[model samples]
Target: MNSEKLLAILKLQATKNVGDIIAKKLIAATGDVEQVFKESKNTLHKINGIGTHVTDSLFANENLKRAEEELHYIQQKNIGFSYFLEDDYPQNLKHCIDAPILFFKEGNIDLSNQKIISVVGTRNITSYGRDFCNQLIEDLKDYNPIIVSGFAYGVDICAHKAAIKNNLQTTGVLAHGFETIYPKTHKKYISEVHKNGGFITEFWHDEQPMRENFLKRNRIVAGLSKATIIIESAKKGGSLVTADIANSYNRDVFALSGRANDIYSTGCNNLIKNNQAHLLSSADDIVKMLNWDLSKTSPPKQKELFVSLTDIEQKVYDYLQQNGKQLLDVIALNCDIPVYKLSSILIQMELKGVVKPLPGKLFEI
Candidate 1:
């Protein structure tokens, strides 16, 4: 984007009471970001959601000053950014109504790979959660997914590390600006994260990682991916907030199931029990749900010859082979297996390379 347009976006972003949704409306009404500032106060006020206070903020001289300062910093540091309307912006995030009009990024981040999933959980991650997270990324390496997370403690950093170890690109969504890294200890991982993928944030260059920024950051993490996975979370935590946001976008959400009494498991278990998320037992569940395996030009039917299946698995395979793709509920009813039991059985068959999952809960041999 040109300097004038960038400054206009920054000014709009700096305006108090003018959020992404409102900024977008102003831009849409005026036909351009720069035009929003050029338009008269009366014209802006005529737009819905633009009241006197909003128009006043939009014209605030202090906002333009701040925008100029930020623009200078961006130019000096050679920072990268993606405007909402630009082709470079993340496609998944573009669909979110409240996504930032512009977001800053750093490192060798690539959005071309569509096999993206965000994994988040509690800051106090358990050993079970950690191991599951590691193995999950390892299993998914073949698919070369872009693993995204908040770059915070526990499950977030764990997922990033695992993705790097598996030689996969992992993007960290930051709650603060590029000027400072939150949780000083994570500074060591920043270089490695940059090498593997990079960091992205909607906050300005010097913005602090305030408490409220995390809530805003969660949406970007959830928005950047095709699905959101909660490895572990308490009954109330930020990861659940991401899950909620992902759900609001009508994206798939998978929650790792743990023992009911486990503290961190409470949130994920609740999500699954409430039908708000799928019961994720393994990476196969994600592979199936996202239909990542369908991209194969010639799926390896040879693996089936060497694979072994339980009687129930064999039954499901036979049914799917005869019926083509079938919904989870339909397969459960026709095969005399309860839906709950069939879900896990299908996942196992998926791991054994006997069946493939399609979108909308459909499955095929």
Candidate 2:
């Protein structure tokens, strides 16, 4: 984008009371970010959701000054950024109603890959959560998914490191600005993260990491992916907030189930019990639910020679062979297997070259 347009976007972003939704409304009404300023206050007021306070803030002298300063810093540092309407902007995030109009980024980040998933959880991660996060990424490496996390301690950092170890792209969404790293201890991982993926933030270069900022950051994490996985979370925490945002966006949410009595598992258990999130058991659950394996466009191969199958797997394979092709739910009903268990079984069968998934969740042997 040109300096003039970026400056206008920054100015609009700096305007108080004009958040992403209101800013977008203003932009749409005026037909351009710059036009928002050119239009008279009376004209802006006529736009729905536009009130006196928003119009008043739109032209604030301080906003323009701050915009100018940030714009200069952006130019001097040669920073990377994407406007909401730009093609380079995250595709999944673009669908969100309240997504930021612009967000700054650093490193070799790529969003063209649609197989993205955000994994979040408590900062005080247990060994079990850590092990699960590691194994999940390892199993998903072949699918080449872009792992996303908050870049905090515990589960967040664990997910990023696991992604890096598995040689998959991993993005760290930051609550603060690029100028400062939050935990200071995480600074060492910055170079590796940049080498593998990068970092994204909606905050300006000098914005501090505040309590409220973390809450606001959760939405971006939830918005940028097709699914959000809560590896662990307390009854009240930011990860749960991300889950809520993801659900609101109509995105798939999976929570790692733990014992009911476990403190950190309470939030995930509640989410599962309340029907807010699916119970996440293994990587196959995600692979099946998200249809990641359905990307195979080639013709379905016959079952591998001399391949061994468990009794249940054999039952499912026999049913599919006899029925030709059938919907997942239908196959589950006929085979007397629960949908959840059937999903995992189908994935296992697919990996063994016994069956392939068609569009609309149909499977054939």
Candidate 3:
């Protein structure tokens, strides 16, 4: 919010390839960033990483003009902006060495909240994945932890929608920028998020949603939250990147287990095997890992039923509950029910609030 400090920092950020490290070094020695800009090349060259290319960039009129234009465009949007050196920037994020000097934010989500959790998973979610994500949202909303997720398909979209449905605040970390929504069909959902929750990115106004941007975006999503839940993921996906970043930040990363042979669950299994993530069998597991105050999390009401059930629904439910997590196909085979019939039955149970869906076609009863 400090315009002078923000503009100064953005000015540094605009210097191509002379990013956080070089900027910090120059700013520290000069005692003020603006002072560094005023100094001659001889003074700039005294710094360890300040070479000829950086010196040229430091004095570039074009870079300075672009920075000013970015600032002007930001103001025109009426969006709230912050600088890392200024007050009201997220304290946790500021601790990172590569923290963005500038952050563009506009929405109702509060970053200063006492507790936050990031939920991420596969875009190709299974029925079980859906139910799993729903239960997490339902349980955590009353406690008011800020839900952070990539606003993509599957679990990310589900997490955001559930939080909004419960009137809870959430934040979506986008790979691109405000210029265009990726997975453009999600425009409606992202639109709702802007009004209710918010969208965030480290990218500039018109940055493309390149394949690599998603990996970089995951760093912010992971860095911003206390913990991350990966409901389902393949051996390779953005969710794995988020988990790795969370670990690097010393945040707890959790991967819910699914079928052993299922490709979608393979990344999660590898995470657990390689010790990047702990297994999250239940919502309580996540709560306990974060050491969150149990009292603040008031789960939704559930009717205790002694109602007798036919052998199939009972079989399916028992399989899920006993294993703590199960995919629909896995459950169907285990319960000896046909896959088609099991689908409808699981849907009914989900509506009844007995089971939860997860990413990568899974369910937990």
Candidate 4:
């Protein structure tokens, strides 16, 4: 068939016993995908995680046709891929073990960059998060940086949108395939991204967006960039996954401060406390990390913060700012308020024009 190296890689990705167990082991023993097929089944069993059945499949190379089919489908969709050893691959991401063997992309982006920062957080973002993202990315835009993110919701959308608005290249790594975009609502922005920036994925076409894919996607978000910034993430947010990956990769990760006692902000604060991430209150912190000379590009126009309040109101306001619209119960949990008295406070806050209720029992600030 005169199959090429890319085809071989496609087949390797198609093999059995390759799901999180023996994929790395086989790569270690065989030294690469092509060599894995060359090794005898008996010989392959010597690797730590590989078993007789896995070695047998390694010898038979049963998935070659499946891979060829996948490659054909991938080609039909016009998705592009870059191997770790290929010239087009992001050199920084190459060092990551969990790095995709092939990155499927559709967009305009200078994949090669002096610096990249992955900005991520919750999908239910607040005005504060929106403001933080706007200011932080605006400052870093002059660096002509590549911004990496998952392109999901909340902070990811904000980051990508800001980068595009600033005319900076932004890459959104996807959890699903190019064949289908999860949360199709993002098509407008993602299309614009492809026109300028690009979308990337490891999974081939027809791959479902299993929740784990998001976890897998976060590694690329963390690895592809020089640093990672958490604008507003909850205690168990996926942005923390990116931070964890960044720390593992020995990359710089900055987290913006959230209001005291807010669940969404607790993750960033904990990251700062554990010394896993540095504190970031303004755009200056990000610029300092890249050490870029911003005199080159036009400085980003800043946003105006509307209204002010005392500490208690600020706390309530800040909580609303991160959660977008939340139910009264959610508000209570977020603000750590006893349900009994939270209603009067919320009502007062609403009257003050600090928060407003929406249909379906939600409030936005």
Candidate 5:
């Protein structure tokens, strides 16, 4: 984007009481972000939701000054950024109602048609949570998913480490700016994270890691991914808020259940009990829920079609073989397997050439 248009977006972000939603409305009404600034106060006020208070903040001298300072820092440091309207903006985040209009990024980041998922949980991660997070990413490695997390202590860092170990791209969404790293100890992981993936933050260069900033950052974590998984959380925590944001975006959410007495499991259990999230058991849950590619090792072979099958796969194959083509739901019901597991089983059967998938989710032998 041109410098002129970039400055306008920063100024809008720096403006008080003018959030992403209102900024978007203003942009839509004005036809462009640059045009929003060129319009007179009276003209801008005529637009819906752009009242005196917002207009006053929109043109405030101080806001412009801050924007200019941030722009200068960005230019000096050669920072990379993505405006919401740009082609490089995250596809999943673009659909969010309150996603940042502009955000700075650093490191080798790529979002091109990638399978992404955010794994979040309590900072006080338990042995159980850590093991589960590790195994989950290990299993998902075959699918080559990009793991996203806060890069904080406990579950966040655990998720990042697991992803790195699996050689999958990982993104750490920061609460503060690039100028500083929170939890000073994390400074060591920065280089490794950048090499593997990168860091992203909506804050300007010098912004501090305030309490509220973390809350605001959760939206990005939730928005950037196809689904958000909570490994563990207290009854009240930022991860749960992320799950809520993901749900609001009409994205699927999964929560790992734990013993009732475990402190960190409270939030995840509550989410599942309330039907806010799917009950996540193993990696299969996500594999099935997201309908990710099940043939992880190789493409289906063209050999003569004879292959062995598990009892469940046999039931599905026999049903299809006898019944001709059938809808996925019908097969699931007749085979007495839930649609979630049935989907994966069918994919395996297809890879073995025991069944063929047809258009509109139908299957046949």
Candidate 6:
């Protein structure tokens, strides 16, 4: 893009009170990003959602000066970037209403004909979470999906490392600018990450990794993928926020279930219980739900068709077979079993291949 257009986008990005949605509105109203500045305050005010405060911020001289300085920095460094309206921008993120209007990227990152998913979770990852994250990435390597994450501790870095070990591309979404790396120790992995995939961020060259920036970074992680997976999470954390954002974008979400008493598992269990995410037990669940091509890769082994079933399992299996598909609550009611007991029974049946779990607490024979 030309310096003028790039400067205009930077100014719009720097403008206070003007978010991605508002910036897009201004661009649409003027019919061109550069033209937005050319239009008079009166003309710009005619656009819906463009109030006096927004107009004031848009025309602020400070914003222009900052944009010019950043533009020069970008030009001198020969940095790469993608505009929301451009074809090179991530297609999945382009559909998000709150996606950044412009963002910077680095390395051999390529999204063309790629299957992407974001793996995220609590920074305090347990042994189980780490094992599952590694196994999940290794198993999915054959499909060659681009793994996306925040590049923070625990699950994020674990996902990135697994992808690297498996020779799969991995993208790190950052909260700070390219001028500095957060968690300074992660600086060691930068060269390797760039070699395999790379990093992306909306923050300017000098921006710091503020508290709110991490929350903002979560959106990019969620928006760039076809699905978001929470390997593990606390009762409340940024990973859950990303899952919510993915759901808002109408993307598939999967949560790994853990023991109910485990503190880290509480968030994931709640998501499954509330029907906010699919109960992820294995890689097969993702492949099946996403309808990925099983012929191209070695599929996971299925349970024996003639496996024995317990008396309760037989009763639930027969109920599911007769009903076709039923909700967990409904299944418990109809089978004359309590929900707590029925959950375990259903899980056993699922392992036996006599029952399958679907979205929304649904089960099928």
Candidate 2 structure quality by residue, lDDT tens digits, 20-57: 99988988888999999999999989999899999898
Q: Against the hidden reference, what TM-scores do the models get?
A: 0.81, 0.81, 0.79, 0.77, 0.80, 0.81
Q: Which stretches of candidate 3 lie over 4 Å from their true place?
A: 1-4, 296-365
Better of 1 and 5 by TM-score: 1
Candidate 4, lDDT over the whole model: 0.78
Worst 10 residues of 2 by lDDT: 296-305
Give lDDT tens digits, candidate 1, residues 1-365.
78988999999999999999998999999999999989899988899889999998888889989999999999999999999999999999999999999999999999878899999999998879988998898778778889999999999988988887667899999999999888897886787789999999999999999999999999999999999999999999999999999999999999999997899999999999999999998989999898887466333233123677788888988898899999999999999999989987886575444675555798888
Q: Candidate 2 vs candidate 5: which has greater lDDT?
A: 2
lDDT for each residue of candidate 5 in 108-219, tens digit (9 for 90 to 100): 9997655899999999888789889988998787788899999998889888878776677999999999999987977767877898899999999888999999999999
What 10-residue stretch in candidate 4 is worst by lDDT?
300-309
For candidate 3, what is the TM-score?
0.79
TM-score for candidate 4, residues paired by index: 0.77
Clashing pairs in 2: none
Query: Model 4, 221-246: lDDT tens per residue?
Result: 98898889998888888998889989
Q: Report lDDT (Cα) of residue 308, candidate 1.
A: 73
Query: Looking at model 6, how many pairs of residues clash?
Result: 0
